[model samples]
Structures are given as C-alpha cells and as structure tokens.
Target chain A: MAEPVLSIRDLRKSFGALKATDGVSLDLRPGEIHALIGPNGAGKTTLIHQIAGGITPDSGEVVFLGEDIGALGVAARARRGLGRSFQISSLAPEFSALRNVMLAVQSRQGSSFRFFRPVMKDRSLTEPAMAMLERTGLAARANVPAAELSHGERRQLEIAIALALGPRAFLLDEPMAGMGPEGSRALTAFLDGLRHEAPILLVEHDMDAVFALADRISVLVYGRVIATGTVDEVRGDAEVRRAYLGERP
Target chain B: MSRERAINLLLAGLLLSVPLAALALGELFYITLATRMAILALAAVGLNFALGLGGLVSFGHAAFFGIGGYVAGIFSSHAFNQTPLFSWPFEFFGSDQMPAIWLAAMLISALIALPIGAISLRTAGVYFIMITLAFAQMIYYFAISWPAYGGEDGLSIVVRNGFPGVNTAVPLIFFLVCYVLLLAALALFALVRDSRFGAALQAGRQNETRLAAVGIAPFRIRLAAFTISAAITGLAGALLADLNRFVSPSMLSWQMSGELIVLIILGGTGRLFGPVAGAMLFVLFEFVLGGLTERWQFFLGLILLGVVLFARGGLIGVLAGKARHG
Candidate 1:
C-alpha cells in the first residue's frame, strides 16, 4: 500500500485529572474515509484536535504528509493542506454562505491584503467559492446568511468551506452531529462521494451513517483504539461489540 | 461603485473641505480647532483597528495615546533645555523634530501594547474590559505621580516642533499635516479590513473555534492588530501634543478612553469614516454647546449615554443603513 497520508502514534493528552486521550494511534491513507466511533467522553474529539494542529499532545508524534507537525500552528497547518470541520457548526453566522466559503478561498489564493480594490468586486476569489458551494449542493442557499441556514444546510456549508481551502485531507468532527434522519442520510451520501477526492478522518456518532459510508472504522473507547477494520471485521470484533455495541443492545 | 459607496465618498469629500474653508475665511482659531478634531479622529482611527475590526474593545488605548504625548513633550523639553534626560550609560537622547518624536512614540506604544495585549487576551467578555481598564488606570497613575514633564500640570512645547517645508505654527499648514495623516490612516484601515490577516482577525472575533479549525491562531492575530492599533494611536497622541503644545496626565485618563469609544460608537464602528464623523460631531457639539451653555459637558455626557443605550448604529450606521453585501 502507498505511504499513509497521516499517522498518529502513541498520542496522549490529559486535562487536570482526566486523561482525555491515552495512547491513541491511527493511520489514514489517501482516498479513504476513516471513521472514528466511540461512546461519549471517549476522547475522539481530543484525538482529532491533536491531529488537526489545534491542541498539542503531551506525548507522541503526528506525522502528516511526511512532516512531524507538532510545532506548526493551525493556520500554518492549513497552509500545508490540513482542513478541519468543527463538531459544533462553526461558520461565521452573520456572513452569507457564499462569503463564508469565499474567505477560505481567499486565504489559499493570495495575500487577502489587497485593500484599495473592493472585495465584492474581486471575482478572482469569489468565483471559485461559488463553484465550491455549487459542488456541495448549497448553490440555492449561497446568498443566505449562515445563521439563517437550516442545520443540515449549515453542515453542508461547513463542508463546502473546508473544500474551498483545497485541503489534501479532511478532519471532519461530527459532520452529521445535529442533523435529523433525512439530513444524516443525505450527508452520508455526500461524504461517500468525497471519499474519491481526498482522504477523510470522520469523527461521528451516527452509527447508521458510519456503517453505510466509512471505508474503514476505528472504535475508540476510553481514549484507546480497540479496533480498526472494515465494517464486517469491526462488526464481528468481540471487543468493539462488548465495549460499544453491547451498550446499544 | 454602488450608489451608497458613491454617496459615502461625497460626504467624505465635503468633510475634508471644511478646514480649508475655515482657512479661506481667515478663521485661524477655528482652523486650529479643526486640526484638533482631525488629530483626535486619528486616535479613534487607531482604536477602530482594535474595536471595529478585531472586536477587542480595549479600554487602555488612552495609555498609548498619553504615552505618545509624553514622549513628544519630554523630548522637546530636554531639547529646549539642552540636557540629557538621564545620566544613563549611553545617555538618553532627545530631539525636537516632530517626526523623530512621533516615530519614537509609535515604537514605545507598540512595545507596551505587546505586554498589555498578552495579559488581557487571556480573558474574554467583561473580564477583557476590566483588564484593559485596569491597565489604563495603572498607566494613568504612573503619569500622574511621575511629576516629570509637569505631571498633572502638563509640559508645554515652547515652540511648535519643526516639519520640513511647512510653517508648523501656521494654522492652515498644521491642519494640512493632520488632514494628510487622517487620510493615510483611513487608507490603512480600508486596506487592513480587506486583507487576509483582517479576515482572520474578524473571524477570530466572530467565532474563535472556527478560526482555529481553519488553522488561524486567534491570539497572534489579535496581538498583531493590537500592536498596530497602539502604534497608530500613539502617532495621533504625538500630533495632539503638537497641536495643543501640551502633554498632561489627563490624556491618559479613563475619560479619554471613553471618549475614544464614544467617537467610534457615534460615527458607527467598523465603517472607515465612522471615527472621522464622530470626531467632527463631537467637536462641533463641544463648540456649539459650550457657546450656548455653561454646563455643556453634562449635556454631552447625557447625549453620549443615550447613543450607547438607544442607538444601534452611530451617525454612519443611521445614514448608510446596513451593508448590502461583503
């Protein structure tokens, strides 16, 4: 197999007395959807935070595209093609969906420092942002402020923003977190399509969506990965079933 | 351009021509007062960088503004007396040249803001407001107690500091200097507002987590903006000192900070000319009201409180309404 696009080894982080992440390890390859699933408070979000360059791990190395990016900041990491979506919808609520995506595009294109030239007239940046919105099925909602968007549309807009950054990989934290059944099904299909474009590390709670779209799944329990495999392998694994699936039953 | 932007431009042009008209009418003192308005507006322009775009709401900007004034005053005083400020190893040098003083003022304010911003940035909401206010009070006390440069009494510039090719004492020429700087400041504000760094700054204010998700560090962005904002305000302080030929502890007081905020709120925060309009209105109100009543400031404070409590948008906001698009 080709070299893994992202590798996390023995990652650990603690908050006060709580060990949020304990020896978490995973690897993601190009063009694959890797879903991380766990019970509440399992440190899935913490692990994602460390990987996305938001929080520094107390121990372990995060190697992305052959670089040990422990010291780089969030924007520097993004400049290197690491994009993240928040578990809680995190768009500029007052900004129109189009402008929100356009900002991400603006950061990647050139210095957003051109001031004398009017921003609204800057087609060089806005055109691509609009196109990305079109790709994400948000063309109809482009003019609406993000705050006005339905929860499902905001999730789609979040994905569109990540896409506009032209990321090499996506770290999406609960993209379908607050969506209804219809929203979840629609998002799962959209994410399934994205698997062909870039490797995605999806942290999600929707079991049905995870089972439907993930190329591979890692079950995290108490900050440690108990299993990483295809649907059949993970579903059949006794440890994952006992630790997570058993509770569902 | 849109009809709205075109109208905004026309208003700016009309405002710009006022001091020139004052000069033509031979109202020299009024010209000087207009110069004062521009300089104060320039300080608000700096505050705009932090308050308007970055949403920092710094109440300590008066500290930087006062520091800039004191730097000019101390330098000119030492130059006039022809003595080293202190008997340090290298000796503290002094210059009466306004550019030299202004540059030094900018450097000092930026350096000071680094520490102030680092500490204040740790907290958000009301905590940020209190911390900034506390820092400004600390500076104000220091200035009041120092007793150097006359402290509460203020230091005066015996002669107006020299500017190249201009009679710096002449009201029209001085007003021109202030006008040019105000425009330069407005241009910088317009540029920074549209820049990528500006985008990240505003985003940081809107939703810090979202900014972090996009790989932008809110702290660093805020720090850069804070330092630049302080530097701009410091430049204004130096100009103010030159205009009045005085630097007093009052410049560092909390009241000055409140007035700066009032200027932005009155003009409309975030708009380029908001501070300018606020400054003009403030000066006009002070002049006109002071002429009409003995207790004008009481009325002015009442009006300002009304604006803050009742007015969602300042003058510009009321005039321009909402921005239709980005």
Candidate 2:
C-alpha cells in the first residue's frame, strides 16, 4: 500500500481545563474522503486544527508524509502541500474572487517579486487562477469581490483557494455548516469531485451528506474517536448509535 | 471606467503633472514643496507596510524617520566643520555621503524596530498602538535630553550631504533626487506587496491563526515587515534632513508619528499611491492653510477628525474608492 499522505498517532491537545482533542488517532490515504463527524463541541475542529498545525498537540504526534508537522507553522505546512479551508470565511473580502485565488496561486509559485509589470497583467498567474476557479465552478463569479459572493459561493471560493495551493491533501472544516439544501448539494458535489483529485479530511455534521460521500466515517465524542468504520458499520454500531447516532432521541 | 479606477487615474495624472507644471510656470517653491510631499509620502509608504498591509498601526515610525535625519545631519556637520567625529584610536569618520548615511540610518532603524516589534506584537488592537507610541516617546525623550549634536535645539548641516555626479545645492536637482528615491521606494512597495512574502504579510494581518495553520509564523512575518518599515521610513528621514539641512527632536515626537498615520489614512490605507496622494494633499493643506490662517493645525485637526469619522477610506478612499490589494 502507498504511504498514507497524513498520519496522526495518539494526538492530544487542551485549552486550559478543556481537553479539546484527546488521543485522536487517524490516517488519511491519498484520493479518499474521510469524514470526521461529531456533534457541536465534539472536538472535531480541534482535531483538524492540530493536524493542520494551527494548534500544537500537547502530546503524541501528527506526522504528514513522514515529517512531524504538528510543530511546523501554517505557511510551512501549506508549502508542504497541506491546504485547508476555514470554518469561517477568512478571505480578503475587499479583493476580487479572482485576486483571492490569484494570491493563493501567487503564494504557490516561487516568486511574486516581479514589480515593474502589474500582477493583474501577469497572464501566467491569472490564467491558472481562473482555471482553478473554473474547476471549482466559480468561473462565473471570478470578477466579483469575495465579499460580494454568496455564502455558498464564498465557501466554493474557499475551496478554490485551497485547490490553488496544489495540495496533496485538504482539511475542510464544516464546508456545509451554514448552507441551504441547494448550497449543501452544490458543496457535496464539489467535495465528491474533489476526492478523485486528493485526500480530504472533512469535518462535517450533516450525516446524510457525510454517509453519502465519505469513504470512511469516524464518530468522535468528547474529543475521542469512539468509532471508525464503513458507513454501515458506524450506522449499526450500538456504542456509536448510543453515543451520537441514537442520542437524537 | 469604474469610479475607483477613474479617480485613481485622475489623481495619478495630476500628481505626475504637478512638478512638470511647477517647472513650466517657474514656481520654484512648488518644486521644494513637491519634494517635501514626495519625501513625506515615502515615509508614509513605509508606515503603510506595517499599517495597511500588516495591520500594525505603528505610532513610532517618526523615531526611525528622525534617526535617519540625524545620521545625515551628524555626518554632514562633521564634514562641514572638518572635525574628527568622536575619533577612535584607529578609525576616521567624516564621510557625508547620502548613501552611507542612509545605510546607517536603515540599520539603526531596523535594529530598533526588531525589539519594539517583539514587544508590541505580543498585544493586539489598542494595546499595540499604545505600546508603539510609548516606545516612540522613549526615543523622543532620548533625543531631547542627549546633548551630543545640539541637544533639544538640534543639529544643522551647513551643506547638504553629497551624492555622486549630482549638484546637491540646486533645489531642482535636490527635488529630482528625492523624486527618484520616492519612485524607487514606490517600486519597492509594489514589489513587496505582490511577493509571496507580501501575501504572508497580509495574511498575518487578516487571519494570523489561518496563516499559522498554513505553516508561517505570524511573529516572524510581522517582525520582518516592521524592520523593513522602519528602514524605509529611515530613508525618508535622511532625505527630510537634507531638505531642511537640519535635524530636531521635533521630528521624533509623537505628533510627527501621528502625522504619519494621518498621511496614510488621508491617502487611503493599503492603496499603492495612497501615501503619495496623502503626502501631497497634506503638504498642500499645510501650505495653503498656513497661508490662510495661523491656526491652520486646529482646522487641520478638525478636518482630520472628520475624515476619520466620516470618510472611512480617507482621500484615496474618497477619490478612488476601494482598491484591489493582491
């Protein structure tokens, strides 16, 4: 088997008294969709944050492609092909959607030091940025500022920004958190299409979309992974059902 | 054209034509005034790096600015007097070259900015502003109390610092030197704004957490920007000293720092020519208003407060609207 693109071994983190991510272990292989599903405050975001190197794991390790990346910073991790989308939209709202993605592509390219000619005229940068946007279904919204994009469109733009980074893997935190049915369907399709390109560790709550898209589902409860299995296995496991699935009652 | 694009083009055109018109009309004073605008704008451009791009509202850039001026002033004074500059047992020191003085000023400013940024970046928002202000005050007081080069009265250069093949005494020639440096700094600002490093810097301002998640350290990016910021402003300081042939503690005061911030805001924070437009407008206001009323600053304060509260985007924002930052 090929080496898993990302490997987490007994990762742990705490915020004051709260154990945000407690001994969470997971592995993500290339070209797979792994959903981290948990209720609100389930430590799902914290777990992904640790893996993305946003927060340091207090114990254990988050090793990506054989390197202990938990200790590295955000840009360094991004430079190494790990791209992520924020739960909250973190784009430069004032900049156009094209410029937003261009900034990402600009970051990926070695030099942005060419100053005499305006970057806007750099077809080398803008062409690829537009192509990435087209791939994410945001080609029509390319000229609009990200602030002007709809919530769903902005979310797509976020994914587009990540894709511009040319990541081998993606950490998408709640891509469908605030979407309507149409928005959710659109995002689901986008994620489904993305899985063929690179591994995505999806943190989501919508079980219907989660079951429909995830190759594997990990049920997390109170910072610990209670169950990890095929969709049917998680749906049938009494412990997972009792801890999360059955808890709806 | 879009309203923003139209206004930017108009403003750039006007600024580009000002010196040419001044020369054509034989308004020699306008040349000096335009030079002042370019130098002050250059300093504001430096502050914009920290303020506009990095979201660091540094209120201490004047300290760097004045330090740059003093380096030029001190060296030129020693050369004019033909006196030994605190001569050590071995090293002789009386070079009054502008490049050498600017280099010294940049090094000093960067050194000062490193420690100041280290401490100020620890806090966010209002605290950052106050800490930077306090550090500038520390330097201001140091300049006031130290009796080395004229104490509170300040040092005067009898002759302007030398430049290769340039008549440093002629107002038009001097204005051209400042103009060229202004363009160079503008080019540098444009370069930094578009670079991968520039993206990281802007990201650090917008979402430090997200930036860190991508594997860049926010503290390091901010520190580098702050240092470069001081260095650029320091370059402006060197020029400003040459313009007046004097250096004073007033240049390092908090008021000067506040004026730098005002220039950025008045022009448009984050806009490329915002500082240039702002500097031009600010000098024009001072010249026109000072001629109109002795209490021009009080009116300037009233106008500034109005701009901050109502204009939101300042002159650049008012004229150009929102700019596209890459």
Best by TM-score: 2
Please state the CAPRI-style docking class of candidate 2: acceptable
Could you give me the TM-score of model 1 versus the true structure? 0.88
lDDT score for candidate 2 against the true structure: 0.84
Model 1 iRMS: 2.5
- The local lDDT score (0 to 100) that residue B249 gets in candidate 1 is 88
Q: lDDT of each model, Cα atoms only? A: 0.86, 0.84
Show how many residue pairs clash in every candidate, following the order shown: 4, 11
Model 2 DockQ, alpha carbons vs. true complex: 0.33
lDDT at A48, model 1 = 86
Model 1, A1-249: lDDT tens digits are 989889999999999888888898888899999999999999998898888777899999999999998888777788788878888888887678987887788778745444455555679767999999999899988899888899889989999989988888899999998899988888899889887778999999998989998889999998889999999999999889889998443
lDDT of 2 by residue, B1-326 (tens): 66765765676567557777888999878878888998999899899999988989998889999988888888788778778887678555666888888888889888998999999998889999999999999988998898988889999888888888888888878887887788788778887887666776776777676455444567877888898999999989999999998999999999999999999888888877888878988999999999999999998899888988998788878876666664
lDDT of 2 by residue, A1-249 (tens): 779889899988888899888888988988889999978898998887777766788998888888988677777888788889989887877667887787777768754444345567678779999998998889998989788899988888889889988888999998887889988987888789888888999998887789989988998899999999889988888888788876653
